[model samples]
Target chain A: MPTPILVVDDSVMARKMLIKALPAGWDVEITQAGNGVEALAAYRAGKAEVMFLDLTMPELDGYGVLETLQAEGLNSFVIVVSADIQPLARERVKQLGALAFVKKPVDPAQIEAILREYGIAL
Target chain B: MNDQLLLTPDQRDALQEVTNIAMGQAGAQLAQILEVFVQLSVPRINITESSSIATSILQLVGTPQSVTAVRQAFSGTLRGEAMVVYDQNGCRDLADLMGYEDDIDRDSERELLLDVGNVLVGACLNGIAELLGAKLSFSAPTIMAEDVEVGRLINPQQLTWNYALLVEVHFTLEVRDFTCHLMTLMPEESIVALKSALDAFMENL
Candidate 1:
């Protein structure tokens, strides 16, 4: 079965870029959310085995979503794909249980490397 | 129509996302300087007439009694004036950061704000230019207005362009009361280049 993936960002352009950057044969069924609210709803619907989240968003944002996930003990493998590259932001997301931080204009090589290191491939 | 805005709705969204990443770089620079985490709001894009530019700007920065602003001109593939607006409270916080909290006279206060404007505008504009695969250089930041009303902030006669595409970004210090707005105004011609760049960005995706 294909891995269920959730890609969330407020900008449609960003979402498209992220989807394009996914590993060539990741074998994942992808769903998208425009903001944190939609992201949570999708996660609750069991659509987020692995989640790619953007930091700055409308209606609660990625931090809020991560906090919610942590509070509820949700076990999605969350990778934060964000424009906010501050060191503190990276640390904060890690503390909130995110697996990794990837910068904007998503790099396909970087995505592949991260996936390979984590043994998250098919 | 000649009066039609350059960017379509789709283009605007791409431009905003591009700007958000650039703003993140600028915000990180600010966080390093102040040793405080910065909270960035989503970037807002608008295309408006020169006559009402200040009004839209005022609306974005909130309808405050007075505002201090620093303006710098960026020239190259993308050319425009970038303005950094700071409210009184934020200016006070900046004054403190600049170590002028003890005795900030008029000149020192102006210098302090210009100092911030210089760092932020240079970093942010460079980030945007880099992301768009373009090059840009900026003029020295200058104090554009000191505690002025919205109407007096920008004179329509001084604007050489009929329309400008404004990208407004706001950042607030996480632990302090410091807040500022970075607003970029690109004239119609630059918008054409920006539009092409935005299209190219989304082309392969």
Candidate 2:
């Protein structure tokens, strides 16, 4: 079965860039959400075995999604993808249980390396 | 876009996303400087007539109020001016953030605002230029207007351009009351360069 993935962000362009950056060979089923609210709904709908999330968004943000996931003990692997690259932001996301953080203007090779480091099954 | 805007909706969206990433870097710099989380809004781009920019600005500032604004001109693959506007209370909050609690005088307050304008505007413009793979140089930021009504912030006669593309974003302090509107106004000539730069960036992605 292909790994289910969720890419969430308010910007259509951002979502598109992220999708393009995904490992080309990874057998994945991709789902997208415009904000944290939609992301949670999609996750509950089983479309997010692994989630790539953006921080600043309308309706609900990435931090809210991470907090919700932690509160509910949902262990769907989450990798935060955001333009907010502050060290404190990174630390907070890590503390909130994000598996990793990737800065925006997503790099394909970086995404692949991160996936590999996490030992994600492609 | 009465002039039959050169930018399509798709292009506008792409530019806004690019501006978002750039502003994010600027916000992070602020957060680091003040030791407070900075709240960044989604970047909004508007193509407006220079004759009516004041109206757009008044709408942005919301309800006429005394404000301070700083302006810095930049030149490169893109050329334009960056303006940072703050309400009086926001200026006070920024002063408080910098520990200027001892009854800041007029000159001191203006200086403080200019310093902040440099920090936020410089980082944001630099980030955009870097992302677009363009070289940009900025003149020193100067106080454009202080303690003026939003409607009087910019004189139409002083404007050199007929049409401008304004990229606007807001940054708010998470715990403090500081909020500022950062706007980069690109004139007709600069808009052509910006569109091509934006196109090149989108192409790479």
Best by TM-score: 1
Clashes of each: 0, 0
- Cα error, residue B43 of model 2, in Å, equals 1.0
Candidate 2 to truth, TM: 0.95
Question: Rounded to one decimal, what is candidate 1's iRMSD?
Answer: 0.8
Per-residue lDDT tens digits for candidate 1, residues A1-122, read: 99999999999989988998898877999999999999999999999999999999999899999999999996999999988878999999999999999998789998888888888975
DockQ of each: 0.82, 0.73
| Candidate 1 lDDT score at position B168 | 89
TM-score for chain A as predicted in candidate 2: 0.97
Worst 10 contiguous positions by lDDT, candidate 2 chain B = B1-10
Query: Candidate 1 chain B: worst 10 consecutive residues by lDDT?
Result: B1-10
What's the DockQ of model 2? Answer: 0.73
Model 2 share of native interface contacts: 0.64
Check candidate 2 and list the clashing pairs: none
